[model samples]
Target: MIDIKNLHKSYHMGKNSLHVLKGINFSVSEGEMVSIMGSSGSGKSTLLNILGILDEADEGTYTLDGTLIKNLNEKVAARYRNQFLGFIFQSFNLINYKSALDNVSMPLYYQGVKRNVRTEKAMHYLEKVGLADWASHLPNELSGGQKQRVAIARALASDPKLLLADEPTGALDTKTSYEVMELIQGINDEGKTILIVTHEDDIAHMTKRIVNLKDGLIIDDSKVTQVRAKAENYV
Candidate 1:
């Protein structure tokens, strides 16, 4: 569902330029769950940003779900992002005052979906993430794991073609992280394409394949026996 070839990206720091991604090539197919693994300065974040269309690559070709992604105007990029990609961040990114249900409904609202329909869809996703009972709670009222579940529900509410998670379990405890991964695993089993950007080995192992990045390039790419996270063990 995603294709990238020889991607290159750099940032200028006064007189010097910091090369973030150099000659990087990556691809993820439909119905696949893949993890991009890397250390702090490994360029995983830069790659994710380019994949999410939040940032432009200085050089490279990216095609998502049959659409060529390059040099789009902000308006068009936003439209494509809403129509095709769902993002989950380490920080929940929920509006502090908004309840879980409201946060989940935000994307649909941006898509100009009707209020009633969006609300119904939001509730359905909240249920999918096992957060329907917590729907009325605000982010502050929920635990880290609950907040992430809400974030996951929000990402899924729109039914986007690709789900992009950036350090999804970064702020959670080990048990909570496993619980969250289990939820993610269940979603993948239902046949959605997912790409997770993570630095944790256990987190990466949860996915079907791992692509290791270093020095701004992919150093290793291989499939692994997926470690299924048992949410029940944590519960």
Candidate 2:
């Protein structure tokens, strides 16, 4: 579902340039669940940004689904992002004042979905994430895990082809993290292509494949035996 070749990115400060991604190459197939792992300065975040079309690569190419992603204007980029990608951030990124239902429906609203239809879809996804009863609660009113669940619901409300999660379990406790991973695993089992960026080894092990990055290049890309998160124990 994602293709990248010779991907390179750099940030310039004064006379020096910091190259974050250097000659990166990888492909993620439909229905695959993958994690990008790296330490600080590894350029994994930069890679994720490029894949999300939030930023452009200085050199190389990225193709999402079937369309080439390069130098698009904001309007076109936004259209592709809405139609082809979904995002889950560690921060949740939900509006403080909006209820969970409203937060989940925000993307659909941006896509011009009718109010009733979007509401129905939002409820469906909230239910999928086991947050149906918390729909009326605002972000501030929910627990950390619940807020992330709302974010996941918002991302899925679009039914996008790919899901990009950045440090999805970063802020939660171990049990909560497993709970969230369990939810994510179920999502992947249903055939949603997922790419996660995480520094935690245990978290990466939950995914079907891990791509290790260092100094702006992929050092290792291998499929591993998936370790299912035992959220049931925590519950």
What would the per-residue lDDT of candidate 1 be over residues 109-193, giving only the tens digit for each residue? 9999999999999999999988899889999999999999999999998899999999999999889999999999999999999
Which segments of candidate 1 are over 4 A away from where they belong? 232-235
* Candidate-wise lDDT, in order: 0.94, 0.96
Model 2 alpha-carbon drift over 4 Å, by segment: none
What number of backbone clashes does candidate 1 have, counting pairs of residues 3 or more apart or in separate chains?
Answer: 0
lDDT tens digits, residues 1-235, model 2?
8999999899999999999999999999999999999999999988998999899999999999989999899999999999999999999999999999999999999999999999999999999999999999989999999999999999999999999999999999999999999999999999999999999999999999999999999999999999999977874
Best by lDDT, which number?
2
Clashes of 2: 0
Ten-residue segment with the worst summed lDDT in candidate 1? 226-235
Flag clash pairs in model 1. Answer: none
